[model samples]
Target: MPIKSLLILISLLLFTQNIAAKEYKWSNKLTFLGFLKKHGIPQKTYYKMHKEDKELIQEIRAGQSYSINRKKGKITTINIPVSDELMLQLKNSKKGYTYKYVEIPYDLIERTISIKMKYGFKKDLYRATKTWYYGKELEEVYSKSIPFNKMRKGDRIILFYTQRYRNNKPYTSPQIDACLIEIKGKPFYGFLMDNEKYYDSLGRQYKRTYTTRFIRPVPNMKRISSRFTHRRYHPIHKRYRPHLGIDYAARSGSRIVASSKGKVVFKGWKGGYGRTIEIQHANGLKTLYAHMRGYAKGVNRGTYVGQGKTIGYVGTSGRSTGPHLHFGLYKKGRAINPARYVSKPSAKTIKLKGKAYNKLRKLVRHYRPQFRETRARKNSIIKKESKKCLNCFKKLPPRKK
Candidate 1:
């Protein structure tokens, strides 16, 4: 009886040990995403941060433990490390997403930029944040939303893109990105879950083209000031002051055309710049006319001038510069070389330039060869069809009356 009792006690102990040893292990067998949902954590936050990373999408292994730490109902951290050439690190619930939008400035040194939001984070990703670029006053740039999906680890972006001028001047601005993540097994590089957030934030089109104004800028015309003799070293100053403005050689009092259509912001003497006119063009562009013998009739400050219209004439009035028209081009408030904007003066010139750049030569060469090949193929097909019809003795029926 005692032996029987001992055997029963051992059996009970073994049963208890078996139940207790059932280890709770998570696997890559279940979707790493599915596990998060089953555990009752938010998937939206995770999805927002890594949606754009194609490599990360490929490396997710089922049955692999996704190390995460939670506080209350929110995910504080996620560490599923993958290794690749581009080092990508993901961080959960770091700081709220932030951004500032800025408009192009007016002046030549600095542009007129406006901010939408100050630096702050919202609880929800749907909220918009704004900021501005201030040269003198605010210019109203748009706000940006937190990119939940496109916001990946090690992701970077620019708030504003500096436009190129004819002279190819360089401008500097800040580039910002999210912090890097460190997962255990492999380092998933270039992973941004929903990073397309900032780019798509303003609902602004990714692709852009000029459509509103009819008058576009021209490019590559000879400037008389760029002549070699004018570049001679000054004797008194004992230093070389390269000619600042480009001179277009023309007859005295010739019809000086407006480079682009814009309101005349200033039309008067600008120091040594004699009888000058400045026209404000669209998209932060401006043009200057200097050394004019006389102003064009009906041309004045605040007047809307059309492109190619006679705004003034040539003269050597300001500082003995020369009898050439001094032309200037300004973009984002900075002076650029004028040669970049000289397009054709008429439709005929435009067509000629297009023909030079287009496939007219290649098309001419290919036309005869392509026509011959097509004719041969057509003849072969006709011969085959005729032979087949004759063999079948398929004749056309009489047309109905």
Candidate 2:
């Protein structure tokens, strides 16, 4: 009787496994082609990808997690995130293996993490949360203005951030909205603005001394078909989605020029992007032009091109619904709004003023009340060893202008 029961338990476990999606970590040494081959996916499935789509597979980093659902040990579906907003999905049917780029479905979770310095900011943060992602970001925001060497014991630290979650776990690093650091007894505050820059209580920026302004790739902007956003309700899918790049609606065969001086890194068909070109410019900047008709002569990979030089022609390509160009700008592998970088090159530090500064003031006001509440708490009452936060961010109703 005991032996029969054990066999039944093993069978039940196997049956449950077949219906559930199993998660796996991507190996560093495994190329995208190698991954397909190892899983019995046909080599042609990889070779047939648009050269641009082929380049996108490189964005899959080692240790990145993916999911697979199988039946009888045969893959039925697979989802692998290739970029922050896009995923590579593979489905197996009776005919063959098929793949496409889809939006990576995730939830946005807003949180606040508070800690007191015991073993330094990074170490103490890791101790409380089991992660150390916000250290570099905090340093980048305050390193120039604050003296890190002066941090003393019990220096309070608080951050209000939002992160993307998949499978109920963190999918990416926290995007800090506001941060407060106490040096000695005085408090320093940093608030995030829509421009993706952090400013102090007075709307001053202290990180970089100079800013490199960028130009629009397409000449004569008729209109923007789609704008960049971190979150929005999709009209077709009825889901909250993020668009990392902007789309410019233009006529077919219109001239597309290089946004700035840079060397051509890639020029080929990308999955949904259709015909695409990527250029590597100075200051760790990279620009992308997609959904084009054709490339300019001699603008191959590794060729240096200057700003305003013709690089490609616009057309409907990839998974486009119409004749529009998808333009993307990235800094160190992170997508940022190209709209902010245009026509604002300056040699001196850029400070928030006028309407931009007023917008930042609103953001600061939203976060100030929380700071006041936190200031009342005694350091002895704070959970120095535990990974807990003070309170989540709250938005007050906007006042009439």
Candidate 3:
């Protein structure tokens, strides 16, 4: 199990008579209204909230624990995490009750670890780091290129990674920026690039592009007219606004495809999004294609479509000024940057070229010195651990005298 899950499960809840703080796990079948009613909160709270905020209620998942604090037997504060980066905060005071979306504050911790395979990779990693996640991460980042199962005792694993922490407790999984796994005395390395793809010291990639769950709706856009933003001042409205999606510059009649296979939950005009289609995909992800000129035939609510299936066309609808597609991706109920999720990968392994490749090489160079100091241990790592690998030794036949 990841350390994050362990912490959440084992963490204690503090409570008192005059002042009390308690935690409760969200039930799988619980609805937002159900939660409100159970907690003695007014159901009017949901009906009064903004449309998007109302939708965010769907972000809360089953088994997720939330906190509630009370003073003098009355609720004082409540905090429920809706997403990894955002939470729903409710406050009750003499002024009355109120709730709003707030950003989740977490400290980013960067670390470097080197682990020697004393017992086994999985066992040692858990003993040293309390996580089998890194082991799987290494296996994935070096998939097809390196066989981690082939590693013998004494084989070392080094990683430069970062993780997020909230209230001194880990939540998200650690992200490894660079890794090295010594197998049979040969050093195999992987470096994470800005694009989130992994490459080796020689700039060779083993990941298949199409293997990603999500792909760009507009395959060959000329350029992104506007990128995702948290908040900005609207020129026309003269108010703070947020473009929670990417705007792809294309002709009005250009095709828009499904980012992944999913069932369409909505297909219609969505306020400022204009004509839109929302698809519910696996893992609680929903992709929105807005400002569409037209929807494809037979495409409607409850329609299931495959990845890359044409669903609509580009257009300047709603508040849009020009012909383009506004693409938004949401996980649970929070908007997320699509750059990491959307890809236009080909079938073969991707190799950086020209400036991109040059930049990658520079990054590799920066990481070289950091890991080069451990290269001296490479040869010693491949030695046989006969004590553990007893089968590795040839059976001694009875000598005939």
Best by TM-score: 2
Cα lDDT of model 2 by residue, 46-67, tens digit: 8777544564565575787899
**What's the CA error at residue 112 for candidate 3, in Å?**
5.1
Over the stretch 1-401, how does candidate 1's per-residue lDDT look in tens digits?
69999999999877665433212245635554565577565666444542223212323333333344444435444444221111123344457321111111111121111111222111111122122332111101111112223333322211212222212443222111111111221211111111111112112211211122323221223345452121224455332223433577666767777877899998886535667888999978878777688898999889998877878777766545346776766655445445434422222211222433233233224233422343333111211111111011113233223
At residue 244, give the lDDT of candidate 2. Answer: 66
lDDT of 3 by residue, 1-401 (tens): 99997776655332256688889999977878899899998888777766445544555767888999988779998888866655788898777678865556666666667767778777777777776877767766865456667889877777777666777887666678787888876788888866256888778885633356888898767789988755434444333234567889998889999999999998997655678899999978999888799999999999999999999998877643788888888867567778656754446767788886886788778778867765455442322111111111123233223
Task: Give the Cα RMSD of candidate 1.
Answer: 30.1
Stretches off by above 4 angstroms in model 1 are 1-223, 227-242, 343-401
Please report how far candidate 2 places residue 177 from its true position, in Å: 1.9
Residue 363 lDDT, candidate 2, scale 0-100: 76
- All candidates' lDDT scores? 0.40, 0.74, 0.73
Show where candidate 3 strays beyond 4 Å: 1-15, 27-58, 105-157, 165-170, 181-213, 218-256, 262-304, 311-337, 346-401
Ranking according to TM-score, highest score first: 2, 3, 1
The ten-residue window of minimal lDDT in model 1 covers 382-391
